[model samples]
Target: MSEEQREAVLDEALDAAHVDAAFADQLFGVVDALDTSVALRRAVTDPAASEDRRSGLVHALFGPRVGEGVSGFVADAARRRWTTGRTFVEALEREAVRAQLRAADDDGTLEDTEDGLFRFARIVASDRDLRTALSDRVVPLEVRQRLVSDLLAERATPATLALARRAVAARNRTFDQTVEAYVDLAAAQKNRVVATVRVARPMTDEQRQRLRAALSRQAGRDVVVQEVVDPDVVGGVRVELGDEVLEGTVSAKLDEAKRLFD
Candidate 1:
């Protein structure tokens, strides 16, 4: 199935499970099991197997091992059609992130988690050694997870830590990419889009509000502004919402003008 179809399936499971904070650990456990064993992943997600057979495989493997909610989720997931075992595993990971977001929302710290993740991503992006440590495949997974724990122990929420640790375990994406993806998912959970706005200086409250309103209208969704102070912008602002970047900075305009003259 396509990614959109897979997301739809996940949405169905999330709604049915009434996913809460506790489900995050359960989903993590499922992902770990799949990550550690190719056989188990294939057994549960095998397309040639009947849906009932797949459901049975989930029950045989995880029914006694996991909670009722987790078992139900596994069975439901196994019953869905996936193009590959890898995609099935990815579906579980997405569910885990979604559940964690739901839990954060329940605890009234969704925004905190969201901001903490973005801040950590920025920190990693700037620190070459730290990014190398987290992304190093030669390092043991336990060591990487410990590094994440030590860094975020007192500085971040439990949800942020959980998501960060899990991002390292992503099969197909780099650690930073996974964390950014998680941030995007968290923003979507809030029915908002993340707009990274670069400026020469911080905006006043009025300016921030007006900019958010304008971006919201442009994006056709509620916009959450992640402010970055960048002196190189010189003047005006550069707004990045996903792949579409609106570069209104003086430097960009000057470069355009220079190119035209050239």
Candidate 2:
């Protein structure tokens, strides 16, 4: 019910000797199934039902369809307490993305996958038509997925492509938002915090290194910088790390000075 409880369940589900792309795929399949079936979602998260009973229901419904690993994971998750069926489904989805990113990490393409997701998100954010097409439920789901695949096939890693297609589902969020969430998860797979940095110009390798190091020290952890070159920043930099924002941009300073005068 609490965030800690949910995180505990997730950590337990992911605690394995080895996690592969197949495992991630299986989890995604389960998430899709639960998301589409309201009755199934309710059945698994029913408060009146005993934990074992709920877990049994999961095994009965998915045991034959999914592999043992995923079956066990789903059953275990069903046995846990969730605030709502929607939260249960979201937890599964989050774990699926984490597992997929873990696979990319294992394959040494984690950075590529993160960059692909970030770049795709930026592209979608800039193109209104592309965003509409991807997020429009009126369009066939397959068509939207196909469009994503076609756009990223050559540029993205397999993990990135898989996540991009999943983003088209968009569940409760926008397409770009879902991709950004995946990008954050990718950074988490490496035990790094994500810092979205905006600047008037691109940073050189040395500048990037220094900024990353400074952020890492400030956060008390490794930090991955997702740089956005925004001319509106007009010099200096703006760093968004989770809820905290560090603004040193010329525009921000000018705004402050104008406010004082006014």
Best TM-score among the predictions, by candidate number:
2
RMSD of 2: 4.3
lDDT of 1 by residue, 1-262 (tens): 6767877877776866767767778878888888788898888878889999999888888888778888888788889888878778878878889999989988898999999998888888878999999988899989999999999998898899989888776677877778888888889987899988777677878778777887788789999888887888733467778877766534443343223212
Q: lDDT of each model, Cα atoms only? A: 0.81, 0.84
Worst 10 residues of 1 by lDDT: 253-262
The C-alpha local distance difference test score for the whole of candidate 2 amounts to: 0.84
Compared with the true structure, what per-residue lDDT tens digits does model 2 show for residues 18-85? 67889889999999899999998999999899999999999998999988888888898888888888
TM-score for model 2? 0.91
Best-fitting candidate, measured by lDDT? 2
Task: List RMSD in Å for every model shown.
Answer: 4.4, 4.3
Worst 10 residues of 2 by lDDT: 253-262
